[model samples]
Target: MLDAPEVEELTPPVRTLMGPGPSDVHPRVLRAMGTPLVGHLDPTFIDLMDEVQELLRYAFQTENQWTIPISGTGSAAMEAAFANLVEPGDTVLVPTNGYFGYRMASMAERAGGSVVTVDAPWGKPLDPADVQDAFDTHQPDVFGFVHAETSTGVRQPNVSDLTAIAHAHDAFVIADTVTSLGGVELRVDAWDIDVAYSGGQKCLSCPPGASPLTLSDRAMDRVLSRENPVRSWYLDLSQLEGYWGDDRSYHHTAPITNVYALREALRLVAEEGIEARWNRHRRVAQSLVDGLADIGLERYADEEYWLPSLNTVSVPDHVDDGQIIDRLLNEYDLEIAGGLGDLAGDVFRIGCMGHSARPANVQYLLAALDDTLEIETPKTQ
Candidate 1:
């Protein structure tokens, strides 16, 4: 066996995640993940799945019957939403403000749909008039956009306005709530979001495998009426519903550990109450903004479009973005990410998600950032 390549036992150093995702998992969730593994179809496990669905509904603040966790990560949930909803030759309008928006456009194209893009600068919200103009120009079969533009820390305000515009044009809406669901204010039912999906890692304070998704009756009707079969067998929501819904049939084996972690995370959300959790995120985010300003850093997005859960800071002209971030990782062992696409290296993304939103964690990041920046700048006096 070639001596098994001289394998050595390894232990991972503890990390404080202050980046885009996989935020620090709570102790309760970690304990839950260690529970004995049970067969996916076992009655007990099925019961837990039902509870998971219910908890997801609560977390999403929606009574939609189709709420369930997709087995893969958040991206899989995003694919499933578009695949099931967009038919071949259908025109789908997508907003181009950040990285995920482009991913949405690509997925729609793969589904054989024609795409029309409504765009804004990276750090701004999609203008309702622009979406209206697209509706007038394309007359799309469906429309979608990101609730929180994670790449630039911009949250679309008055989201219901977009929904109204789409509805007026008789089109369905797919809302990407991956980074906003638990950390920001999202109302699937009240906002009339037809299909919405979110990840467990960011603000849910769970491991990264589980993603929560919900579809309204109108979206489900479109899926049932589609002439062509869903492009993905694994991601086929109609078939997956039998397993995730009433029949509770066997499909793929669920990620038992991830499911356990999600259950505890959702429980924590419910226990804290949704509104209270939103308030906590907002308060911590304000403190983070203040701290960044104190260290002479500037936020990228305007205050009107800023997302409380994730903040994008503009790097000073003389400061080398990568060097400072590297120092933080090597010296303080904190994790933060640089920007994406057009804005890369011009900004730094610091996430104040879930458990990482605690004041102490924010304070640690603030102090480390101040010290790192001071050391990196040359002494003049």
Candidate 2:
């Protein structure tokens, strides 16, 4: 017989999360997760599910009846949107500006769609003129772009203009709002975004199991009439509809605790008002920006396209980015991140999201940063 291993009681560090995602969960949401779970189709749970969908719509600023939390993280919601919308032989236009845009292209290809690019440099938002040009050239059936790119800390500006271009070309629109939903200025209906998806862990300040997704009637119509079935069976929206839609039927065993947590998180959003929460993120993130500037760290993206939820700043030429990041966690229990893809080793990504978007967290982060770099805080900062 194998010997029993010595395992200790579970105890994780209480570190402040200021990374790209999985932001600090709100206390109420954490408490909600501890509540007892019921069957996915239980009457009370079904009622809670309806409440969640309504709250999601409110947060998305859309009247889309198809809004619901996907069974997994933000990526799952993203895949579902693409898999259902892009059928075999369809031409899908995707941005080349950030990481998630590449993910969109991959998903589209997997769904048997051909992918084309709308080009923009990393750390910059797509220019409408360029997007219109791409549409004129490719005449794609669908266009996908990242609303707020966590990898580059850039928020796509002129959303309405971009959507207008796609609509003029008779193409459907899909948006990756993982870092912007509930924490940035986004209006799905006003902007005419046909499909949008987000994660619970970023601006929602909840855990990662459940994600938010929404589809307009037009978008759903495309999905329902797709020439080929969606590639992901678990994520097939038609199958998922039976559960999240009015039927409230069996599909998969929902992540009960994560759904409870997401409900509480969206409740916080409704209580705060979406616009107020966006402003709060900006206010707190501005303080972080000021401190970074005072410390000679420049923001990677310009102010007009800056993402308040995720801040990317240049690493000083002389500083070893990895050492400082490690020291901050070891000495101060703080968590920030290095940049990804093209910006790797060139920038530091710090998040000011949902529960983490508070003056206390920003001030503490600034102080910890100062100590780690062996630099004194600026008097003005």
Candidate 3:
């Protein structure tokens, strides 16, 4: 017989989340999660499901009737988009500008796609001309791009132009909106994006579990007509349709608590109005940027393509970024991140997202960063 092991009660530090994601969840959302859970298919829960789908449509700015929360984190939603859309032996085009694009390539390849790249350096948005050239060169069946890249802090400009280029080649378009959905300006239908996916923790201020994914009717058509079964049975949208669609059937138990949290988060979005929310993010992020500049920190991404939700700043010469990051967390209980992949150790990735995108939080972050730098950086002679 084994004795019961002792475990401590759950008490995490109160942190100001200013990192890549899992941003400060809204208090309302946290409260929602605590509400009693009902059966996934109960009558009231079914109604809530309808409301969540409608709210997601508003968030994605689309009326495709295919918008629903995937049953896992944001990456699960991302995989759903790729797995259903890319048929075996199909040529898929993805960008080479940031970390998420590489993730897209890996997912597509797993789905049996021959991946091709349209190159752009880190911290830069892809040029439309380069996209057009890649399409002409590869003649891909599907094209994917990151709308607001978390890794590089660059928002791809000329979205309509890129979509047009893909459409001209009869290629479907997929957008990674993980960092932009509610905080940044994104128009799915207006931009002619065929499919788009986002996480709840980014701009929505909800804890990560259920993720948002939407597809145009045209995109759904391709998914329905795929010659082979989707590699991932768990992420197959066609199978998921029975539950999220009118049938309202079983498709694995939905994440009931996460769904509740997401409902409250999207309710907040509807209350604020999407455009006004975008403006707030921009305004708050601008203050963060100006304060960073005043403190002699240089922005790593260009202003024209800057992602307000995720800001990247250059790390000072000869300073260990980890030391500063550690000081901020230990001394101030604030959270930020180091860059990924190509920009690693060279920049700091600070998130101004969701409930964390407040003037007070930004001011606090700036003050903490200033104090840390003053102490850590070597003094001039």
Candidate 4:
């Protein structure tokens, strides 16, 4: 008989998540996740499903009946958006401004889209003129842009203008709000965004596995009328409608715990008031920026498009980013991340989001960062 391997009891570090996401989960949401689960198709679970959808609508600021939480992570919701909307040979325009834009292009192509780009530097938001020029040149069937880009810490300004441009060109608009949905200002219906998707681990301060997604009626109509079925069987919105829509039938076993956590998280949003939450993020992140500036760290993104949820601080020429990051994690139990793509090695990504956005966390981060940099600095002559 094979010997049984001895395993230790589970213990994870208590981390202060000031990174790009999975920001400190609210205590209430964490408690919800620990509650006993109901069978996915049980009457009680079905009623909970209705509550989840309603709460998601409130968080996304949409009246779309099609709003629901995808069963997996943010990427699942992202794939659902692209797979449902991009048919074979469809011309899909995606921004080249940040990391998630590249992800969008890959998903669109996998969905049988012919991808094209609207050019912009990594740390800058898509300019209206560039987007318009891309539409005029490519005449894309669908256009996708990042509303709050995590990689570059740039918030796309003039979102309504971008949507208007897409509509005028007779193209559908999809907004990537993974980093913005609950932390920053986003209005799906009023802004005329055709579709939008987000992760629970970001501003929602909930664990991963249930991501928010919503679609306007026109976008849903296009998905329902697709000549070819969506590329991925699991992500097909029309079939998902069987479960999330009026039928409330079984598509796949829902992530009951994630749904519970998301419901509680969105309830916090309603209690706090969405606009007030947005302002709180702005206020808290402003403190982070002020502290960084005092320590001689400059912001990578311009103020006009700076994402309040994710702040990219330029690393000092003498400071090794990896060293500082490790020290913060190991010594301070604080978590912040490094930049990606074009900005890698040039900046550190410090997130002030959700439950982690409190003043105490920000001040703690600043003090820890100050110590990390000071210890590593060379002795003055």
Candidate with top lDDT is 3
Tens-digit per-residue lDDT, 1-381, candidate 1: 556577578877788899998799999999999899999999998999989989999989899999989989999999999999999999999988899989999999999999999989888899999999999999998898999888989999988999999999999999999989888999999999999999999999899898999999889989988999999999998898788878989878888889989999999999999989999999998999999999899999889888988899998888888888888899999998899998898899999999998999899999999999987564222
Cα-based lDDT at residue 268, candidate 3: 97
Clashes of each: 0, 0, 0, 0
Which model is ahead, 1 or 2, in terms of TM-score?
A: 1
Tens digit of lDDT per residue, candidate 4, span 11-79?
999999999988999999999999998899999988988998888898889999999999899999999
How high is the CA lDDT of each candidate model? 0.91, 0.92, 0.95, 0.93
Task: Return the TM-score for each candidate structure.
Answer: 0.97, 0.97, 0.98, 0.98
Model 4 global lDDT (CA atoms, 0 to 1): 0.93
lDDT of 1 at 192: 95
Candidate 1 collision pairs: none
Better model by lDDT: candidate 1 vs candidate 4: 4
* Cα TM-score of candidate 1: 0.97
Q: Provide the lowest-lDDT 10-residue window in model 3.
A: 372-381
Q: How big is the positional error of residue 288 in model 1, measured in Å on the Cα after superposition? A: 0.8
| Model 3, residue 156: C-alpha shift (Å) | 0.2
- For 1-381, candidate 3 gives per-residue lDDT tens digits of 999999999999999999998899988999999999999999899999999999999999999889999999999999999999999999999999999999999999999999999999988999999999999999999999999999999999999999999999999999999999999999999999999999999999999999999999999989988899999989988899899888889989999999999999999999999999999999999999999999989899999999999999998896788888888999999999999999988899999998999999999999999999888554233
